[model samples]
Target: MVHGRKFISVLTLTVLVLGPGAWAGTETGMKGALADIPADVMGFVCVPSAKALDEKVNKLMQQLGLAQFMPTSLLTLVKEQTGVGDALDEAGSLALIVYEPASPSPDELHNAAVILLPTANAAQLLESLKAGEETDGVRPLSFFGRDQFAFSKGGHVYIGASKATLKKVAASEKDITSRLDPASLGHLQTLDLAVWVDAQKLVKLVKPFIDQLQEMAKAQAQGSGAGSFTAIQLRSMTRSINMLTEGLESAQIGVSLTPKGLGVSFLMATRAGTKMCELVEASPSTDKSLMVGLPADKFIVAGGQIMQAEATKESITDLDALFEAEELKQHCDVQQLGTIRDSIREMLLALRGASFSISALPESPEGLVGLTVVSKVVDGQKWMDNLAKVVAACKKVTQKEEVAKALELVKHEAGAATVEGTKVDRLSFDLAAFTEMEEKEVEEMKKVLGSDGVSVRLAAASPEHVVITFGGGEARMAEVLKLVKAGGSPLGEDAGIKKVSSSLPGKRYSEVYFAGDRLVALLSSIGKVTGNELPIRMAEVNAPVALVSSSQGPCCQVDVFVPMEMVVAIKDTVMQLMGAMMGGAKQTQDDTL
Candidate 1:
């Protein structure tokens, strides 16, 4: 068997054999009954027996005066247990023989009552069953003050007020109801269950308003802005009504439908706790109105202590026009500022009440007799300027240093003057200084280039032109030319040069050429050359060529093949140029010789 089952079997055996009073009524009975419960079942057992009893009583109370409360039905459902039957039989016999109040004395009745009280075994059985064990034939007993009574196979458990206690409760309830408005009391009576039935519901009702005010507070914290005190006042009123409802004895419910929206409040009071809940929904017609006061002891319970709570909500809408009216603006003026401050203080007291901690400013300022004013006014860029104008006007009217100091403090505390109006602060890498340094370096390079004979000129050249220049004389420019050739070539080789020419000519020039993939020609000559390698300084006016018949063919050979037509035409042009030059040269030569 499981450990839990084994333990339970052992406990049951011990309890059945042991007599009454062997275990303490509270501790030992609970330990013995719950020792064998599994971890998950322990939750049911660990819950206080009184709490379970209270829940059972509540359930039975709901069934009161209904068809389910019939005596035979109640007996079959709630009281047909072996242990309960035995206890009732014993009590009934004693009542008939010894506690016949009509014939017996009061002392006999008292003795009979004492004997009818729950025995140790009965109490233990009841406690164990209440710890989550199922019971059969449990029923409400009308004789036991009309509260709930249950019977199990093991024993019986009862929950109810005594006759005298019930009378006192009824009387107290009557007293409280008498003071309330008759309409309100009637409205409260219509509720089906107690107001404190669900604490979460009450929290839901008030949370939205609190959340709205808190948002406004956070915005106010960021900077000077218009705050929704009107919203705060409305929420405070709702909280008060909710607290009042939660603390009522009759489980009364009240609902109000104003132009602003619906307001629902519930009140419930019990021996353990009292609670009130009020929920409000804003309507279309709410104006620039404020609820001014609330009760000090709003949510006090039976133990004279306040409950801990968190009240916040997520679905509240904004009341823009209500907080932004011109009349509200007038209320914030300098002359009326004191009234606003006092109103705020009163509103705070109403909302927080005496149940919470509240600190207040002293009645008078110490060491400084200055007027201090606090208000949430308009939000705009010009707010500070307007405030400064007001301070200047006040300074002009008053000569007191305290007034100036007070204005200064307001300006400082408000943090209005320190913020830039339009400019936003931002961080960026500083490239401006780097750019200035670059410009200076470029200027130095220009000066150095001017002093050197070497000139650097940028140009655009085609691939063929660049290759030709690289192969001819500008081999120093091959690096860039080779890169372009490599990029464009399919097979990746330097092709031979085809043509090379310079734009400028007639200057003293040197030739350093390469041919057939090697240096071959490097001569600089002014005279013309013949096919036979004969230097022709000057050609004859009428030149003859010898003719010879060779096996190959009849050939006319000359040191150079100068056509007769080209020689005659050249001689005539040369004689013309010489005749003009001879006249000028002889004239100069005759004078010199």
Candidate 2:
């Protein structure tokens, strides 16, 4: 326990000594210094210049209008204590290398990491540390025991578990020459702060531990009915664990501030010939232009190609087995459940691609938000027939008096609406049909769903494609259906989407986009019902966030980012909220007096 606490404390101290924005660094400055660090370790974090990072980050925060919200007094106090602040000021770079423990014990784990800081004047840095011992900064850290735990040699200060570990790292001659890809090295140099994990090394390191855990789970599942459930869950977890560690090659994540915006990006590469890699490999029908027909006014838009329907169906099947366990089989009809599962599998098999969008249409009569879903199927007519069958099955179950009353609460009316000179099937719902309700509640539902309830419309754009709209009324539905049937300026060409396009992969399995400010406003509009007043009127800007997931053979990459304007909008909202709270507190105090 003592060693564990010491380990955590030392890590916390590193952050304090480096000050704010310490994690942001440039890799160009770390070229020669990388030679001292071992490349075979599980993972490592590198910061090229603490002073430079602090300046860069502060400037970014100031530009984003968030500098005022950050608290830095604790950082100042820690720097004053450790004196490593001055040391880092003259340092070229700082690194923390982590290794797999020989055994999963606190002490062994404690010895499994090392810190290296390369400074111009190692002697001056060492003197400052000695000076801190006379003060409060280095006194509490006496357990590190004199100069043995940390020592300076050849322009680098090494800190480790003990003299033995320190010596080993200091003596290590391995460099990160061919260990990292050139592109990865480029990312390291450019990103503000970056972490790279060698997944292959990680798998080797954790294999023994995983094996032990599996065995323990098996033992626990041996003698009871509940144990069977545990075994099934453990089996699922272990499979996922194995896939991540064994099937992945490497992963890198970094926070960056570009001229356009501040965001974090993640890249992952999977190992060749692995099941996970094969699963992510792109298919022929994977469409990158799926978002083209989506409405530009939407607050949220998500479109994607189904990559692994079989895997999804299999997981659902597992759930079915779980529900059918001996101790819990009476809660549902197993036969009907099986039928539903089969129906869902059939639907999954039929799905080729889908896209959906949500918008808070404040300009509409209802002053509400709504959703629109569009799917490109193999056969639109067949899909609709299957959907009708499912709905009929649902209606059959509502014959019971209680069920009938419950169902009546959502009064459904089947109708037809014209779209692009063609009749489209439609179903509209009156949500509060069976209960006495206030006008305010109806308006509230309108505020959430664009209508008092929902309007589902299905339009067969072609024999092969189907467009569906939910919640938005006739005009909105007609507009969406026209876009699908005839090409127009896509959602991808929208200003918000354009802003983050450069950050997204050229090809992707799926993508999602968010109108940040609109989402904030929508949430704020519903705050009264949740008993909280969200500060939505604080910003007058449209900031968008986008996410894309793609795979190039075995390498699968996902990128999520927002432009810098969104950061500023978020900061402004937070500042206004804080001011309001403070004012309320002051008013309360004055009233007491």
Candidate 3:
């Protein structure tokens, strides 16, 4: 039986996956259940077997060293709520199929969704219904907060919004399961949970909602000229929304738990020959070498390829129009702004990829955080030229009192420096220069950073790339440029990083790598300083965390991989915290006595 809470959860999952499975195996009635699904469904949610999933989760919990903290059995709760017996044990799979209107009616939509439950004993299941009456071969019942129809046939029980829906599914002779991708089905067969959707059909079903949104936007812009900045921006956004919906062909999501780790993957495929598909096709793969020149000990490293030229150019034109608008034109110099815009466009057009690295977090609020950013460009000279223009334009605006103060600080605190034959721009400042703080607090910050001033540097890493350095000073800048000159392998080529990356899809538009071991250590140190030690003491594990987004054929895939060691640490930490809380409560009771 489908309860309201559970039904709503299924529906929520369907939507979350939009932007974004086990049976107790056996020949179990899965085949018959699939055969009864309506062929023209807008979408369907499938659970291979609730019992199988429960077993797999319990086993995984045990594998992660969480057996002592296992929760109550899921099936027991289901039986308590539905008043169904062993009949559920024989139920191999559950499916809820969403369909278009059966027939248009003036009163309300005739649209419906049907739930198919495969059970060998239909009589036992029927007896558990709270209130129902037989009508023809179907039973009319109140389920999921509404009047619904239910019937049993061919080792399965079908329930839906109306008898018409039940009839279509029960009479389905076309193998509806054939519509799904074979790969998705194969994955579902082995995973604990999964969902697949016919994206095109879903778009048709949700078109009314999209249309309403567009109408609302038009209403908001009622009196504005079509050529107005707000109106043009609105139109552009609407086009993007339509393209996203119309371009998608299919989508599937899967969740799995194993000794390696727990994994959730979402894949979305665009229709062939669509503009969205073309955009993805034009995206370049992430260059792993972009990680070079970044310090090897950074806690986080992230990089991605830039969008195609057409999109960038369109964005620049929109900015120009925005600056020219009457409302904005009165604020500042339009001509200088145009120069800044052109320089920006030049820089963006030459960019291929960029990467950023955070070496360390500040120990205190006043402490300086250290980091570096590098951009791979086709023409480094153009990047440098544009950067100078931007600086000059910014200087012109400093005539204002507040602006002049900031400009003076920049000129006083930073300037050009020679590091290993390369002219690098460096900036160094103390918290006192920017904010009012107690002298002792300022001293503490300086002590933590090992200097009275925090510094950053900028330099051309190569003929094709430029680099920016923060906090590490000349030594760090020299080291970074040395790596560029050496053309050495990036830290990602290390064994730990390679292991994590290899587990994810290889053709990525973007990727992020995390040093979990260093992160945990940092957190532990922070906890000790704050006098809040964690209950469970964990040793640093050698696994790295990775998130990668890539394209496989027409499908867009985003995968996040967290190593099993991290999972174990998290589980142990949670269990220990609960135990400590319980112990504290007992101690409090004794004290009251």
Compose the digit string of candidate 3's lDDT tens values, residues 1-593. Answer: 34445445324322322211222333333444455566677666666566666676667656766657655655565555445566654336666676665332311132366666567778777766543778866887655445667888775677766677677776776655676555344434544445667887766766787889999888765657655667767777887787789788878776655556656677776777987777655666654544755656545444434456765665666665665554444444667777777787788878767777765544544233457677778876668767877666665643567655664555322238777787776555545676766776566556445352565677776788787876555666787788766765465565566777656666677777776556656556545654555555555565667777776556667777787777677667677778889999999999999
Model 2 agreement with the true structure over 531-563: per-residue lDDT tens digits: 576744546455577777765555666667777
Q: List, residue by residue over 1-593, the lDDT tens digit for candidate 1.
A: 34334223222311222211110113332333222121110011111122222233334334332224423322222234222332332111110001112222333222221111122355454453332332343333422122223332212232222232222222332222333334333333322111112223333444676667666655553444334454444544555545554443223332222121122333333212433212211111111111111111111110001111122121112123333434445444444443333333332222210111011111121110111111112222233334334444443433346544443333112331111122111111222232444764443332322221122111112211111110111221233234333333211111210011111011111111112101000110101111132111232222121111101011101111222322343445465557778788998999999
In order, the Cα lDDT scores of the candidates are: 0.25, 0.63, 0.62
The top-ranked prediction according to lDDT is 2
**Model 1 — TM-score against the truth?**
0.18
Report lDDT (Cα) of residue 49, candidate 1: 27
Candidate 3 has what TM-score? 0.78
The better candidate by TM-score, 1 or 2, is: 2
Models sorted by TM-score, best on top: 2, 3, 1
In Å, residue 435's CA in model 2 sits off its true spot by: 5.9
Which one wins by TM-score: 2 or 3? Answer: 2
Superposed on all Cα atoms, model 2 deviates from the true structure by an RMSD in Å of 5.1
RMSD to the true structure for each prediction, in A, is 48.1, 5.1, 5.6
